[model samples]
Target chain A: MRRQNLALVMTTVAAHGPLSRAAIAGRTGLTRAAVSSLVEELNTAGLLTELGSLPSGRAGRPGRALALSERGPAGLGLEVGVGHLGACVVDLRGEVRGWLRVAADNRNRPADEVLAELATVSRRAVTEAEGTGLRPVAAVLAVPGLVGEAPGTVATAPNLGWRDVAASGLCAQGLPLEVENEANLGALAELWHGTGTSDFIHVSAAEGIGAALVVGGRLFRGARGFAGELGHVPLCPDGPVCACGARGCLEQYAGEEAVLRQAGLAAGEDAVRRLASRAREGDRCALAALERAGEALGTALAGAVNLVDPEAVVLGGAYAELGDWLLPGMRRELTARALRRWPPKALLVSGLGRRGPLLGAGMAAIRRIIEDPAELTVSRSRR
Target chain B: MRRQNLALVMTTVAAHGPLSRAAIAGRTGLTRAAVSSLVEELNTAGLLTELGSLPSGRAGRPGRALALSERGPAGLGLEVGVGHLGACVVDLRGEVRGWLRVAADNRNRPADEVLAELATVSRRAVTEAEGTGLRPVAAVLAVPGLVGEAPGTVATAPNLGWRDVAASGLCAQGLPLEVENEANLGALAELWHGTGTSDFIHVSAAEGIGAALVVGGRLFRGARGFAGELGHVPLCPDGPVCACGARGCLEQYAGEEAVLRQAGLAAGEDAVRRLASRAREGDRCALAALERAGEALGTALAGAVNLVDPEAVVLGGAYAELGDWLLPGMRRELTARALRRWPPKALLVSGLGRRGPLLGAGMAAIRRIIEDPAELTVSRSRR
Candidate 1:
């Protein structure tokens, strides 16, 4: 009961904080005494901090406003993309205190070598965060693959040539770790910081395409946690054979490699960037390539929309970079194909872009502390 | 609090009943006095009945079991299909007390005329149910189109030539009426009585394909309540143009008319029945047509499965009748196209088949009473 009340108070402040004790009591229906006690415990834990006093309308002394502390336990986010590695630290206020990104050709590379590099990057981020007086409580790693039922395992990452890789133990030492699908993390980022809808679809692209569904404000992982394989949904039953042995998958048309190939560019780290610049310069081949990819994406999304009926579709990752060129064809195809009285209201480009997964990973870890502050308080007492 | 306890007792009996009063109290965490009082009120409301005594192993007299009533406040289910109209009554025990179905080519038919016929059919069903000592509380009409947000309105049912048709007022007068999409109801019926999985896709077909999603034991209606329009999902992309003005829709390849056309059969009320018989007899053209249609259905469903990742796919409505012919092609395409490590676990034919929509409509009405028996009891007191 105490833990529950603590969580209720913590969540109340996290959601609508910068509040006085009286205001929190009124909002939570807890007595002012209970709120004060809870707030005091939270303050001692470094999870809450007093800000400037609120101005009282009457002449009485004003109560200090309380908000989530920025110097307490933070979240260390790590990512292993097919072509890059990233690490970041986010505070309880959802602000990034440390950020680092490095490009690497990780496809089919040794998982150990790649993870060693990631460990160095994460250590640097943690060091930077600690220098700023922010303590990272846990680390979350986002991978472009199916996260296994077992903790910290990536079941498969076709683009990375990784299978059954246990990522946490080898990467961020001294912190408890959790592994998540990159697309799922991106969708969570969109939910928490971007469009903020309770229901929407978020699609991201890198070497391969990935999509995630957020229904009722929660990630809708299908029964076996393999939902949102939009890249592999067959677009042309007889077109091209894909790496997954499917014919004419959406990836064959819209994935980074496919778009680069169609634009007559050699596959490399800067290929998508070059293609985007060429499209921006009104190059016919680049524009046509992106246009075709967008149409294929829209067609597959039309099917997804028909099935799940989300409120909006947010383009993220590489697609966000290329959205200006992609949106026209996608909108045309979606408008032509959607079986609705009205087209879906919004097709958005994610502001978080490629950074969504790493930030979402950080937020996810911070969220755990906020949701159950008792864990931190109990562990602190034990220490 | 009293109303909640009353609903708890009612649902407990409905789920685990033929249970004794002592069992109800133990399961519900209510005192024996509380259980007895709530049971008495439910008994007076005709929502529950005393069953034969349980065979208690202990000494002394055995307790009488309780179950949902077989009479009173039943559900009246009505459906307007493309080629037929149906009405039936389901008791709280989920037994169909009365059944009626009439053939009518409702396509392009006047909404008023068709509703008049439905009213007659519903009246007969209600009368027959009353003859069997059952009193219907409300009627739910299942239509083959999108039900509007407003009460009693259908936004569009292309197959039925219905647009903004206020069906509740025109049919089943004197009874509180609710309108639902047929596909949605079919999926609900599957959830209640068929495959019984909380997460599955239910696909039904008549002249056009319709599908519904059930997530966490509730129907997942998209933002606009237009989530499942599988018929219009593009399958061939450049094939035939659909009535919805999209090219290569799944309906062009998998709908009844499409299959019948491919089989060199005339379009009529009995076309599907004839095609099924011919395929049963191993006719080459019939088998080929059904096989092609199944493949198309499978392709569309593959996209859905990839997007939603349901545990099973229940082939309801007309597809249930043709499961033997459809399952093979669907399995083949799904296996070939799904991006999962393993294909979806189950693809079962619905036991309810074409009757799913009507039975679901009836069950939906009955569920409202089960969820909140207070409304029934309170209204009964006023009466």
Candidate 2:
């Protein structure tokens, strides 16, 4: 309980730094005595330390300012997709310290091999941070499939041929680990830190179109933990067969691979970017392809709103850089299709951009550790 | 505050029978002195009466008993559909004492005509209950469309051809009034007293498919209040044109009109029931029609579960009478389409039958009055 209260205070301070003890008490609604006790405890534990005294003009006593220790535990975040991996190191205070990216051919590789490559890329990112005063106490890995809450089992990731692959093993090499679909993490990031919207939809325009929904500041995993498979929401029953054995899934139209396949371009991020840039430069064919993708995505999103009715939609992932062309059509189709009584909810590109999933993953890891302190034993002991 | 507290205590007693003063104190978490004072207040107010002492053989002092007065403020519930109106009178404790059903043709009628007919039927029901020692002090009206939260206005009711009808006026001539879409009310009824599932999806299958979602024991109105418009979720892009100017909405496949139209029967409830009876008797045409409707409905439900992740789905309204024939195919289709990771949630036929909407409306009214005391002005004034 003490640790939890201390952690809560530390996180509050980390989120809103260098706050006077009175301010921390006001923000957390804790008694001044409780705040002072927790602050002293955290300072003793090296998780928090006093910065200075605040000069209170009308107070009987001046308040001491406290801040999160720069040397406290950090978290590592990894996002693994079909043929790419992204890694980021985040401090305990939720700030990104460093990042790394690598391209790997995971098309036909075994699950363990792909995981090994991801781990290698992650290790390199952590090592590259040299003396940056940030050390990871936990790590979260984001995948592109339905992840069971049991900590690292992928229920399915069609593009990667992962069926119940044990994800805990992938990032559990002597560290705290968690895994979730990348889109869900992105949604979480946007909900908590990006736009501060409590309820919003997040779409990841990667190899496959995926979505994450944050409802009331929590992920709404469906009856199963696989709720946000936005890619598979049937768009057209007869259009094209999807890996999920459905046809006309929104992903089949708007995913990076789908867009490239439709545009007859090579299967690469640069290829997707080139087509988007060409469209931006008034290339009719490229514009048409993105326009088509945008329409499908927008229609699918409107269907989503008709169901969940979130306050906003945050776009992210590899194709996020496509920007206005995608958003305008999405906005248009949503306004046209959503229930006419309510005005269309806002549509905004993800503020976290490519870093969302990783940051979200770190947040998830920290959440898990905080929720189950026994699980934090090794991480805390490492301090 | 004392009156409100007394009312809550009396309602609790009515819900759970005569309770000892100590038991009431324990249940309401009020002090024994407070419970006694409130019980005396309610007794004086003619809302509650003292019962014989509880026979606590081992107790040092037997506690006096209290119960809700059978003659306390009662409530009226009405469900207005295109072709018929159903009404029920319930005690403040939600026990239905009398019910009435009348056939009327309201399709294409102006709002005034519909209100007049509704008034005729409601007055007749109340007149029939005059000698029963119960008079409704409040009324809840359930319409068959999107009822906007704006006071008095029903945004749309396609079946009745009534847009923005002032429902408050319809029921406010002689009593306090509240109105809601039939589907939303059905959900409230299920949430309040149905088999006690904490979280579930309620689908009202009548002229069109509507859904009401209960999560964490409360309704989840999407960003806009139009969260449960599952009827409009596109099922087929090139299928039959929907009334909403869309093609292949689930409603076009599963609505009452759709089933009757497909069976080559007139678009009437009797025709639909006849088709269902024949389907139960293994008539090929009826079975085929039901199967098609079931498949479309099931697909839309799968999408809904993938979004809201409710624990169960309760079918209510007119089409709910289709019985087991329509359920098997729906279950089969949902099982096949929903992500295999989460096992299918349970499906239930509404126990409230056609009165689901009526009871749900009553529950909603009671909840509104309880949570927002300002809505209870008339009831408090009567006290």
Candidate 3:
């Protein structure tokens, strides 16, 4: 009970930022006494600190402002995307301390080569963060593919043309790594940091359209850790064949390659930016392509909405940058397809931008420590 | 802790009935002594009964057979379908004591008239069960409609031509009844009584295609109560218009009326049975209609499967009755559309037949009592 209270208090402060004990008690439904004790325990453990005093807003003396400490346990996050490999380290306060990203067409690259390069980058991130005396508590890798239920295996990465790759120990040292899909991590970033809304769908459109579900503030990884395969969800049924041997999938219409092709731009790193610029300049073809892509995405998402009935559909990745051009068509189909009267603002663009996955991976690692602070202390003793 | 343990023991027995204390302990990971104590408490509370002794195959001593009691704390269930109104009462042991169903075309009928008639039937069923000396613990109404997030309102029932109807108090007397969608109840029933699998989609097709999701043995109600609107999931975006104002919805291709019309049969209650017999007799038109309907249903379900990633798809209601004709097509599309290597036997037919909803509704009510037996005992003392 005490452990749970401590974790709850830490996460509450982490998510909501600096809060008075009374505010935390109100937020967590814990008594003020319990919150105070938990806050004191966390402070003693170096996971939290008091930021002098802040006005209570109520007619009373100022309350102590509690915040996550910059010292102690930190999280190391690594990502292997279709076109980039990135790494970052986040402190207990959820602030990024060190970060690195290298753009490379990873689709045709050998898995070992890319992972090894990623490992070097991840080591540098860890060492760089360590320079500030931060100890690594957890390490997580985000890959753009379907992760198997069992540990250490990337089942398939259609865009990367890789399957059954063992992905557990990509770092310089064996750090009990957790491998999750990039989109899932991105959604987690939004869930823990951006909106903090419990039930939403984060749809990330890149080379592929990947969606992740957040139900009750937790990433809803389904039966085999394959819950959110929105890209392959059939839209037109007979429209076009996909790499997964399926036809009329959402990716065929709204994915980066498809949208780029429709816009008469070569599918490359800057295609989305170019499409956005072209559309901004009132280019009819670019506008038409984006509109068509948005319509297709919205049509498929409408079906998804009818089935899942989420609070909101958060557009992420390249879609986040292009949501302004896409949302009009997307909202039309979603409104037409919804069985319930949607709230005036049901579709939202992710505020995390493209850095969401790396940040989420870091948060996920930090969350593991928060969920079990005893593990953090034990690791600290070992270090 | 004791209360949670008691509920766990009861639910374990309820899900996998007729277990010895040792078996229950093993299944629940509770110590034999703890199980024995919990069993004694439940038996003393009249919630459980021991049936002498049953021989243990590999054990030295014969273990006493423990089961849920067959008396007290009965659940009252009422269902409003597009073509039928039904009521049932089930006891502590999940045994039905009374059931009644009246077929009526409810689409054109006024909400008050239909609900009033339903109330009459429910009162009679409750009175009939009372004669057997069973006390009502909880009452649940299962409506074939989109129930809103806030309780007691049917947002829409496109098939029944109803919308925005306040449906909280339905029976003659004021019973603070809980209203749930029929499909959600059906899924709960399967989750509790069928295979007891944690994650699966229950697809019940009759006048419309209704689906419910069960994750970790609990109903996955989405952001709102309007989750699992499988009927409205667009399959062929431009195929045909749906009653929900969407084009090419699953209902247009696989709904009862659509299938019957395609089979050259007048759409009515008997059409499903007639189609089944005709298909059994090698009638090409009927076979073609069923095949098309199954394929369309599968195509949409495939998209659903891709998004939700359930362990299995359990066909219920009319679909179960017509599984032989539907399985091949449904399986083909589902298997073809899956991103993962799905288990060979991922499709299942409900064994409870059409009795699933009534059973589920009753079980749901009983579950409320089981969750808080203190309430049941308190109500009993008051009575």
Q: Number of the top candidate by TM-score?
A: 1
Tens digits of per-residue lDDT, candidate 1, B192-238, equal 99876888889988788888988889898988778887887788778
lDDT of each: 0.87, 0.73, 0.83
Q: What is candidate 2's lDDT per residue for A1-383, written digit by digit as tens?
A: 66666667766786787888889888988898998887775666556667777886664888777776566556788888777788887765666777887877676579898888887888787876546866676788898777765766777777788887886776545776777788888888777578767787888766777788888778887554656777777777556877666556677888887877766678864676788677778977777778888888877777788777788887876557776678777877777666653344477777677667778887776555444433344236567
Error of 2 at B39 (Å): 4.0
Highest lDDT against the true fold, candidate: 1
Better of 2 and 3 by DockQ: 3
Q: What's the DockQ for every one of the candidates? A: 0.75, 0.49, 0.70
CA lDDT, candidate 2, residue A120? 84
Interface RMSD, prediction 3: 0.8
| Tens-place lDDT digits, model 3, residues A180-250 | 88999999999878875789999997688879999888888888777899999998878799888888889
Clashing residue pairs in candidate 3 (N, C-alpha, C atoms within 3 angstroms) = none
lDDT of 2 by residue, B1-383 (tens): 76567656766686676888788888888888998877775666455667788976564988767765556556778878887887777765566776887877779988887787788778777776656777666778898887766766788898889877787766646577777778888888888878688677888776777787887787888766777888877777557877887666778888877877787778764665788678878888778788888877777777666666677878776667875667876787667555553344487787776668877766665454334332344345676
Q: What is the C-alpha RMSD of each candidate to the true structure, in Å?
A: 2.2, 3.6, 4.8
TM-score of 2: 0.89
